[model samples]
Target chain A: MISPSIFVFAPLASAALFTALMVVRSRNVIHAGYWLLPCLLAVAGLFGSLEAHFFVVVQILIYAGAILILILFALMLTRDVMDPKQRQTTKFAPLAVPLCIFVGLGGALMMARAPWPAIQAAAPGPAEQTKALGLGLIGDYALPFEVASLILLAALIGAICLAKAEKEPAAPEPVIDLRGEIELEESVSAGAADGH
Target chain B: MTANLTHYLALSAALFGIGLYGVLARRNAIAVLMGIELMLNAANINFLAFWRFLAPNSVEPQVYVLVVLTVAAAEAAVGLAVVLNVYRSFGTVNLDEIARLKG
Candidate 1:
C-alpha cells in the first residue's frame, strides 16, 4: 500500500532538489539567495511529512525565516550582487561535478544496501512528543543545551566584532613647524629691541 | 511508491551532492556558505528520518537535530560576518581573488 505521505513528500523533494540546483547554478548571487528560500521551505515540508511537527515549525522559522534573511542581507551588503560577466564556478568545476555525482550515488547505494532495523512503533502524540522533547532537553541534555546557548552568545559577539566598521586610526597630528615659528618670534623681538 | 527511510536517505544524499558541488565549484564565498547550509539541511533530514523510522520513541535524535540547528545558526552568523569582513578588506568576495594565503 502506498503511503499518503508519498504524495506530499514527492513534490517537496522535487522542489527542494530543483531549487537547490538553481541555487548553485544561478549567476546572480541574489537570485541564488532567493532560491534558497523555497529549498528551505521544501525541507521544512519534508520535516512535516516525517511527522516531526515541531521541527517543521523550527525549520521554517529558523532556516527559512532567519538564516535566509541573514544570507540575503549579506548578499546585499556585498558589492557584486549580479555579476553575470564573471564566471560563477571555478576552473575545477568539471571535476567537481563528477565527484559530486559519485558521492551522491555512492551514498544512495550504501543506504540501499544497509539493512536498517527499523522499529514498528508509532511516534507518540504530538503533545506527548513535545513534552518528552522538552524534558529531554532540560533533563538529560541539559549540558549540551547550555553549551549551545554559550556558543550562540559567543557567535553573536564575534559576528558583531567582525562586521563592525574598522575605525580609521586618528589622523597623525599635524607636524607643527615649531622651530620656524619660534625663530620668527625671536627675530621680531630682536628687531623690536634694536628699534628701542 | 511508499516513502520509506531509504527514499529520504536518497533524497538527502542528492541534496548533499548538490551542496558539495556548490561549495567546491562556486567562486563566491557566499555561494559556498549557501552550499554549506544545504548540506546541513540534508544532515537534518537524515536525523529526522532516522528518528521517525529507527527510533520513534526516543527523543535523542530530535534533541540532536535541535543542537545541530543551533550550531548551524551560529555558523551562518559567524560565516556571513567573516564574508563581510573579507569583502571590506579585499574589496571583493571572489574566492580566487582573495588568494593571498595561497602559498
Candidate 2:
C-alpha cells in the first residue's frame, strides 16, 4: 500500500489534536473557524493515507475551502463577533474535563469491540469508484435520494423566507422612535417655560 | 508496517471520541457542525479501512464511502443553514442560550 512512515502520521495526528482543542477554545469565533482548516487538512491527509484519494479532494474543496470560509464570513458579518461579555472560551474548561476522560474510556471500549468487515472477493479500483457510486445512487437508491433532495429544497425555501421576513419588520420601528423622541423633548421644554 | 484491523479501529475510535467531545463542549454552532463532520469522517475512515482489509477487492465499500460523503455534504448544508437562522433569531451563535427545542 505505499504508505508513508510513522513520522508523517504522528505529527499530523498531533496537529489535528491541537487544532481540535483550539477550535473549541478560541474565543474569537473567526479564529476558531480558521482552526478547522488545519484540522480538516490533517483529516484529508489521513484519508489519502487510507487510499481514499477522491475523498481527500472533496474534503479540501468542500470543507476547508467552502464551509470554513463561510463560517468565518458569517462571524465577520455579525457585530459582536467576540465581545468580552460573550466570551466563548473563558471558563468552559472545567465542565468538560471529566467528560473527556470518560469519552476516552468509551473510545477504548469501542476499539476493542469494533466489527471488522468480512472479506470481499475483489477491491474496486479508484478509477472505477466514481462510476460505481453514480450507478448505485441512481439505480437502487434513486427514490430515496430524490425524496431527500426534495426535503432539502423545501428547507432552503423556508430559510430564505425567514431571513427575509425579519428585515422588513425591523426597519420602520427605529425611524418611528426617532421622531417620537424629538417631539417629546420639544414638548417638555415648552411646558417648563410656561411653568416659569 | 503491516496494516491490521486493530490499527484502523483504534484510529476510528480516537477520531470519533474527539468529535464527540467537540459536539458536547463547543458552544459555537459552527464548531459543533465541524464536530459532526469529524464524527462522520471517523465513520468514513472505518468504512474505507474495512473495504481495504476485509473486503479486499470489492466496489461496495468505495460506493459506501461515496454515499456517506454525499450525505455528509447535505447534512453540512442543512446544518449551516440552521445555524444561520439561529444566529439571526438570537443575535448570537451560542447554543447555550437557546435551550428550548421549539422555534
Candidate 3:
C-alpha cells in the first residue's frame, strides 16, 4: 500500500531540489536569496512528512524565518544585488560540476547499497516525543546544550566586534573665542543703555 | 512506490551536491555562505530521516539535530560578520579578488 506521506513527500522533495538548483544558478544574488526561501520551506515540509513534528516547527522557525532573514540582510549589507552582468561562477566551475556530480551520485549509491537496520515500530506520538525530547535535552544532552549556548554567545560577541564600524577618535572641542563673544554682548548692552 | 529511507537519502545527496557546487563555483563570499547553509540543511535532513527510520523512540537524533542547528546559526552569524568586514576593507566580497594569501 502506498503511504499517504508519499504524496506530500514527492512534491516537497521536488520543490526543494528545484529551488536549490535555482539558488545556485541565479545570476542575481538577491534572486538567489529569494529562491532560498522556498527551498527552506520545502525542506521543512519534508520534515513534516517524516513525522518529525517538533523539527517541522524548528526547521521553519530557525532555518526559514531566522536564517533566511539573516542571509538576506547580509546580502543587502554587502550590496551584492543586481549584478547580472558579472559571471556568478568562478573559472573552476566546469571542474566543480563534474566533481559535485560524482560526489552526489556516489553518496546516493552508497546509501542505497548500505544495509540499514530500520525498525518497524511506529514513531511515538508527538506529545510523548516532545516530552522525551525535553527530558533528554536536560538530562543526557545537558552538557552539549550548555556548550551550544556558549557557542552562540561567543558568536554574537564575535560578530558584533567584527562588523562594528570603526570609530575615529573624537576631535578636540573647537576653541571658542569667549572674549569676542563677551565684547559683542557688552557693546550691544551699552548701545541699549545709550538708547535708554 | 512510497517514499522511504533510500528516497530521503537520495534527495539529501542531491542537495549536498548542489550545495557543494555552489560553494566551489560561486565567486561571491555570501553565496558561498548560502551553499554552506544548504549543506547543513542536507545533513539535518539525513539525521532526521535516520532517526525516524532507525530509532523513532530515541531522542538522540533530535538532540543532535538541535546541536547542529545551533552551530549552523553561530557559523552563519560569524561568517556574515567576516564577510561584512571583508567588504569594508577590500571594497569587494569576491573571493578571487580577496585572495591576498594566494602566492
- The per-model lDDT (C-alpha) reads 0.90, 0.67, 0.88
Pairs of residues at least 3 apart in sequence or in different chains that clash in candidate 1? none
How much is A172 displaced in model 1, in angstroms? 15
Docking class of 3: medium
Residue A188 lDDT in model 1?
100
Alpha-carbon deviation at B59 in model 1, angstroms: 0.7
- TM-score list, all predictions: 0.87, 0.73, 0.89
Per-residue lDDT of candidate 1, residues B14-93 (tens digit): 99999999999999999999999999999999999988887888999998999899999999999999999888888888
Best candidate per TM-score, number?
A: 3
Top candidate, metric DockQ: 3
Q: Candidate 2 — which residues are off by over 4 angstroms?
A: A1-8, A79-81, A84-86, A89-95, A112-123, A141-148, A151-155, A167-196, B99-103
Off by over 4 Å in 3: A1-4, A80-82, A117-119, A169-196, B101-103
Q: What value does the lDDT take at residue B13 in candidate 3? A: 95
The best candidate in terms of lDDT? 1
lDDT tens digits, residues A55-135, model 3?
989988998898889999999988753377988888999999999999888898888888775545678879999999999
Off by over 4 Å in 1: A1-4, A168-196
TM-score of predicted chain A against the true chain A, for each candidate = 0.80, 0.68, 0.82
